[model samples]
Target: MSEALRRDYRVCEEIGRGRFGVVHRCYSPESGESFAVKSIDKRLISEDSVDRQCLYNEVKVMNLLTPNPNVVQIFNVYEDDIQLHIVLELCNASDLFERVTNRVFSESEAVAVMLPLMEAIAHCHSHGVAHRDIKPDNILFDEWNRLKLADFGSAECFREGELMSGVVGTPYYVAPEVVAGSEYCEKVDVWSAGVILYIMLAGIPPFYGDSATEIFEAVLRANLRFPPRVFHSVSPVAKDLLRKMLCKDVSRRFTAEQVLRHPWMTSGGETGSVAVLT
Candidate 1:
């Protein structure tokens, strides 16, 4: 723990460790409150301009989206010679992946996840910020089990008519346009959301391969398949929403706002509408 961080908050335990750095469960002795403090090594980021820019962008975007309930909140940022400490709302509860990984999510269950997820993304898009990375691992559940979006390290801000070109995103959740090296917009995130929904309902990714290279190739082709055994029990409305979200054509992909009003997303108690996956 950095001495600067320790002065204000008592570091209780190490909660997470990743390629970037460490996340500790901390408490502010002054306020008697607990929070998660993510400390990233400055040298690790300063080595690459893109990495440094991403770190700064993450802080900017998260701060902008702070008012949204479904988005994680960043309370403060502290820096030292060797590290940058970001104080964030700690979700001691399990993440989406850990919560439902091996289980099948019924239409209602899928809605429970997608509705809030889309609402958060819609909020981001309306504010001209694109959460370039969206996946199960980035979604966290609090003590009440309400889902919240986290990890904005890859997020970018853009104007209404602007286009961004970058091959940034996890291989399994990447949009086709991104893999094709085409200038894309916020819709790329919708593609990733579709992949997440697919994983939730089918218990697997729609496009999968043995390696990252193969997965990237599959995403480029955009040949999404819905095996009957896996998708047989999923609702038609749910599948329809997924098809629109995962559309190979960026123009055809459903916007986050549209996704919020989608039938599968709105029809709360009607979980019996099954999709015919041929």
Candidate 2:
């Protein structure tokens, strides 16, 4: 742990661990509040390596997007010769991945989760930041049960009309355009959010395979289907929204803002009079 971090906060037991570091539950004596400190071992990473760049990028992106309720807030950063410690809001509840694996969510429950998620994504897009990696693992819940989007290791900044390239997301949630290695926009995050929605309702990813290559192939095919067995109870409005989100043609895909306005979302999972887009 960084001495500066230790001087400022009471770092406690490990709460979680990730690729480059471990997250510890910490307390700020000044505010009488608890937080998380993600400590990264600098010795394990090279100065000029992609891993080091990603660490810096995550901090930059999070700094740009903080103060939004749905997005995890970064409070402080501490660095020393051996480690880098980031102080962040502590979210005690399990992440979306653990929640989804435990049980499928009803449309109403799904709406509750997706609403904040879309809000976060919309906020990111409006600020010209693309959260290239938006998956269940990165969606956390605070003690108040508010959904908080975490992790920005793959985030990038972009202009409104310009396109970005380089595939940079997980297999199951990657957008079709990304799988095709074609230039894409912030809408790629929307596609990943759509996959999360599908998994929340159906308890399985819409696209699946035994390997990364196979998964990429499936994503490129973009053959979206709702197995009657799992989706029989799902609402048509929700299904329509999914189709719009997971559309292979990026032109037809729903933007984060558009998704927020969709009837399925606006109505709190209840059916509304708005005509479904084809």
Candidate 3:
């Protein structure tokens, strides 16, 4: 543990763990406030390694995108000889991955989730940042049931009209262009969000295989279909939006702003608040 961190906050038990660190539930005794602190061990990462750079990049990106309701807010950073501690806003509720595993979401509920997510993506894109690794595991819910997009480890910043080249992101949520190793823009996030929507409504990913390579093959194919057994009840409007988002041709792929403007998202419905799944 970092002595600087211990001096500032009362770090508690482990709440989560990741590749290079463990997350602890911490408390600010001064204000009686709670927060999550991700403590990364410096020994595990080399000084000139990409992993170390990503750590710095994640902090920089999160700081750039702070104050956005849909994004996780960072509080403080404490580094000692052994570890790096990042103090962040705590989300007591489970993540979207856990929630989806329990039950399928109705169209309205999916809309509620998608709206805030798109808004967050739009916010990121407008600020020249691409959250290259958007997946269910990173979609968190706060105490108020508001969705908060977390984890910027794979995020990158780009200039206007510039393209990013990287195979970053979960297999199921990666865009076809990314799979093809082509240069991509912020629209890649929209594609990933579409995959999340498909999973939310159908309880399965649109593309799947027995292995990662096969899944990548299916993604490269970009053959999207809604099986009657699962999608019969899903609205055509919803599917239409999905098609636009999951389109293989990046030229036709819907941007985050376009997705928010779609009929299904704009039609009569309560989107300002997300559904509190039981």
The lDDT of each candidate is: 0.87, 0.92, 0.91
Residue 19 accuracy (lDDT) in model 2: 78
Q: How many residue-pair clashes does candidate 3 contain?
A: 0
TM-score of structure candidate 1: 0.94
lDDT for model 1 comes to 0.87
TM-score of each: 0.94, 0.96, 0.95
Worst 10 residues of 3 by lDDT: 269-278
lDDT for position 258 in model 3:
95
- Tens-place lDDT per residue, model 1, 1-278, is 56777898998789999877899999999999889999998877665688888888899999998978999999989987889899999888999888667888877788788888999999999999999889888999878888899999899899998999988999999898888889999999899999998898888988889999999988988887789888777767777788899899877789999888887777762634634343
RMSD of 3: 3.8
Give model 2 RMSD, 1 decimal: 2.5
Count of clashes in candidate 2: 0
TM-score of 3: 0.95
Candidate 1 weakest lDDT stretch, 10 residues: 269-278
**Candidate 2 C-alpha lDDT tens digits along 1-278:** 66778789998899999777899999989988999999999989999998899899989999999999999999999998899998999999999998999689988899999999999999999999999999999999999899999999889999989999998999999998998889999999999999999999999999999999999999999999999999878888899999999998888999999999998999998662333322
Q: Across residues 1-278, which tens digit of lDDT does each residue of candidate 3 receive?
A: 77778888999989899889999999998998999999999999999999999999999999999989999999999988889999999998999999889688988889889999999999999999999888999999989999999999999899999999978899999998898999999899999999999999899999999999999999999999999999877777788889999999888999999999998899623332232221
Query: What is the descending lDDT order?
Result: 2, 3, 1
